[model samples]
Target: MKGPALRGDLVTPSDARYERARVAYWAQFDEVRPSAVAYCETPADVAACLAFCQDAGIPAVPRSGGHSLGGYSTTDGLVVDVSRMSRVGVRRAGDGITAVVGAGARQVDSLAALWKEGVVVPGGMCPTVSAGGFVSGGGFGWLTRRYGMASDHVLAAQVVLADGRVVRCSESVEPDLFWALRGAGGGNFGVITEYEMRPRRVPTIVSFHLRWPWDAAQAVIAAWQRWIIDGPDDLGSAMSVTAVGGDPATVDVAGGWLGDPAALERHLDELVGDAGRRPEIRTVQEDSYLDTMMAAFGLTDTTAGQRQWTGQNPDAVIPRQHFAVDRSVLVDRPIPLTGIGEVLAAFEREPRPGQVRLLSFFALGGQVNRVPRTASAYVHRDAQFYLAFWVGLDRDLPDEGDRHAAQTWADDGFAVIDRYSGGEAYQNFIDPALGGWREAYYGENYSRLAEVKRTYDPHGFFRFAQSIG
Candidate 1:
């Protein structure tokens, strides 16, 4: 039987737009040809698509920003894309500012909109990642240390259930569903249409970048870990060692600082003192909150309108990412110097020529840890840091052997970090190869999230490879 007519655009396989509409952020999923790509513009539009999927007995998957690392955003069935629904604004809420954002709003556009009102929310670094997936998986970024996860600021959300009902959930309205929506991960419950978030007011933001020699990777990792774990909450940072195109590996530490510029300089000096090596390159610039975020995203050369995923905007500057094998772990305690060395060595071993290999550590304590673990579905509260490793194959020469080599390297490097991890991983960076994902992603909160899943999506209509149920 034919489903109800949609209130939005639908690009079928026979349509001219299907080729562009079906692509995800990563090139790896480009081969996934969905039956149709529904550009949902409202809650009703989303409901219609879901109903159509159910009526036709075809699978449906939500795509916002299409940034799922595991490529869950695209499937062979139906792709319900919310990118066209994007809208963002800031308004006064009693004594605080509130951001009203469409679930499809990109992080860059949201940041720019809120900065105009002198307010901001914690969010992921990638500019094109949409709010729906990011917050649902517990978003974190440069402002996380000072403001906490993006989901922490959520005041309410509008969701379309599996049964075609549109409802708003918050602390007081559908509280159980609200709790699960915050961090149970996306695509498990229902489709999120909008998000109401509490925004933080900040005028000054200092962006800093420090690069050291490749040989200093271990020392820099150890010292940066200690610096962030001991530093004030005003600081947010991430350190990474990357080797692209078989070039010599390089170590870099970069992030934002909410405190005064002089204080941030002193903190950098302390980091250098601890690492016992002066960085070969250092840059510290104080800019407006929006500009600082733009710089962090490496969008300094592009205007706000151009900083988007390809095909989303004609003038978009960011290209789609290449095939990659990515994995992550949450560390409750800092890794000792020896462990850091071992991990660095693992990154350098059996290097795939022309493949991009990287290991990154994002500091996770401070305001994020101040909240109790059980306060929301995001259970990595006590973790001191979030560590991730990935191997990206060349976009032009993505050979079968390169993929195998990339996967092997990622698994070996991840194993090294897993020994020091707290058996927890970031739900946002979902890994298809991950074992015991339920426990690794949600920990003790899995049961609660499962219960909420049953209560809202009783028929299990909404599910993925590693859904809550």
Candidate 2:
């Protein structure tokens, strides 16, 4: 509080960096009325807490590891809490290595501290995410189809602007706020402590998971959209249709892979070829690199402090049993095979018995499709993959027919996924009543990320829900 109050006015909020300004992880909207939370630890302590919240006008929220989910990293006013400035370094940039990290480093301790020095980047997949809002929204897990997203391995960023000024951008200092802080999606651009990345050298082996059923959600999501339009960008995968336990008709199909492990058992044997005889599989096989990231966090009897950024703040509730529940946002493409046969008959009628859940897909293109959707500031270069879905409501059924059975399977899965995926969405898995969100999160660099949010937040001091101005 006082000590962290950037420059003077050693006031109160009981100081000591506002007692570690707690709360994060799925931060329940404004965490029960927040107002006096401020904690930053350098980059001039976020330019003296953005000059003491612009001379005490008060309205802040930067939080790291606070894994945002529409709650824009939680707010209600003043909250800097840069997750106690955790660091993660790695040198040798010339032809391949560089890493500054810190922005509350945590995606599995910065990927097992850069794979025990072998190096790597393109992070995300829980490991308690928060490399500053997962590189401000262009996140990618499972080594991003071979090292790419995660703002495509950054390059530079030390930010801290909005009247506080602590520059150090890159591609040339302040190159339009380093191209809208790579994929411009974190609260409007400003306080970004550190991130310099450029690492590589992973894949000692990267086996992952799979849990299918509900008649293989449209043949494992249309064979993973034809295995990502002709897979092999080092193979990352996805196929979800969730609602486990209180299932509204179960369906799961998870995936992930990198290399070795006999090429991940021959790529899960061509990804469950012909979708036959493939069920009940849970192998956390490893080849090192920190025991394959401790088997992607499924560590025997897992409990990494019950995740969601320790400060405890999770809430995605809606249980009261079966009825109407609508939510849709689709962007489909030619791979719609009659909407995967009506999502295999509305997931086998209305499944529940032993619910299935697998929803997380990464693996679009190598080098993230040679990036080019405006280099960074993520414009989904014409997308290769990024899918999301979470629908589970059934307590005893009767809340208006569970919101009409979750909006009739979310309007039949966003109208067969927008007739072949193209409606463009993924602004960090959106959910602000699903508006266009700056054309599906910075696609077309949303006007040069709103002119780099008019140079480091021209008064938009890190806004959200359509951030870059």
Candidate 3:
């Protein structure tokens, strides 16, 4: 196998005209570029790159899609571009189905492989998100209410640590790293090459969408708080402040039920029945499990090597949501409207100076909640559901006003969030702005994680803004 330098072209900052390499997912900032992009094609290539960075005393980051909202994967140091390693393989073991997929694998690629077998795995809702980052960060989605987060179904991992050694971690061997790698995230301890995942059988379900006038924003938010408390585990629901018309003022509360159409209809009928004006659209359709997953991603089918994106994937909400934002708390209870106002204030200040959209995934007693906090590296056990403040920026909006609004909205939103969750933040979505992010990302387990970090990377070869010290 070829080394890191040969598998793909390397771009260094010393070169004068490499403009494209300097951008990230948000691409709003100028200094947000990597020192060198090490394009790797195989497991051996990844191992060699880590070794090179180790001996040379150069810090390294791992990039799959460059889709990270926090831009953690693309550090100013060396980056291992694993996007070229997207090879997917599957095997059926008796009644069970096991797939061995590469780290660069995207959601659509892996879901299609599983779909061919008439099976499903809990993955990201976005077609473009890479499996490595998605799983490493506690992945949640429509199927999450049924089988739990994507990390929960991880059976094993093929990991490459900082010191250039390859070891397989599972329930049976290297169990500590096994726990960390499943949910803690990649580049935290090592580079994950393959994931042995537990696949779930797809179900026939009903999907419902209720698009309401902008005036009904408060109504939908309150209704969801009540419905989710007693909703069925099979019914996975989320609400978004999406732009349905010319001006971005419409709200869409859409949910997926893993059961029959009649059952889902009854549930929606009971939940939103009190509201006088019901949504009249018939966007709901019943299909096979794979089709539903594709629909969840907003894509239909795929051609040869080209990626098919639905462009309607649901993303997590951040309180202060601007084109470029920071991470906040993950609370157990939905804040009162009076408090939500502060959140909206920050959202309005997005770099594009637009209103913030709040997205919530209600926790309706699922396998994820049943798993104890200490069971894995992801310790979000008491959480009733996941809350993400998702904001979209008008690329053409004036820079000064947008930044002002975005900052005010973020500062106000964080104030209220502090009242509820002890200033705890989600590590996965954090920006470089927070103080003691090691605690927010890892919680009380930060010290232990640092020990793990020291054990694996004694030379401090893989440091970053939020990495465990």
Model 1 lDDT tens row, 60-131: 999988998888898888888998778899767587668898889998888888777778788788888999
Measured with C-alpha atoms, the lDDT of residue 44 in candidate 1 is 93
Select the stronger candidate by TM-score from 1 and 2.
1
The positional error of residue 344 in candidate 3, measured at the CA in angstroms, is: 5.4
**Which sequence of candidate numbers ranks them by TM-score, best first?**
1, 3, 2
TM-score of each: 0.97, 0.32, 0.86
The TM-score between candidate 1 and the true structure equals: 0.97
User: Over all chains combined, what TM-score does candidate 2 have?
Assistant: 0.32
Query: What total of clashing residue pairs does each candidate reach?
Result: 0, 34, 12
Model 3 C-alpha lDDT per residue in residues 1-469, reported as the tens digit of each score: 1225556666676655345554545545445666777767777778888887776766778887666666676766678878777777767778667777677888888878767776777876677777788887788777776788788888888878877788888899888777777667657888887788887777566777777765666666667766765677787877765531135566677767887788777777775664455764536677776777766765666453435222212232211212645445666676677766655454444333244444433443466777886677777765655555544455533376665655555555566555666445655566576676666666766666677777776776666666666
lDDT of 1 at 241: 93
Residues 303-338, candidate 2: write the lDDT tens digits: 435433333334312111122223333333335667
Error of 2 at 289 (Å): 34
If both were scored by TM-score, which would come out higher, candidate 2 or candidate 3?
3
How far out, in Å, is residue 56 in model 3?
2.8
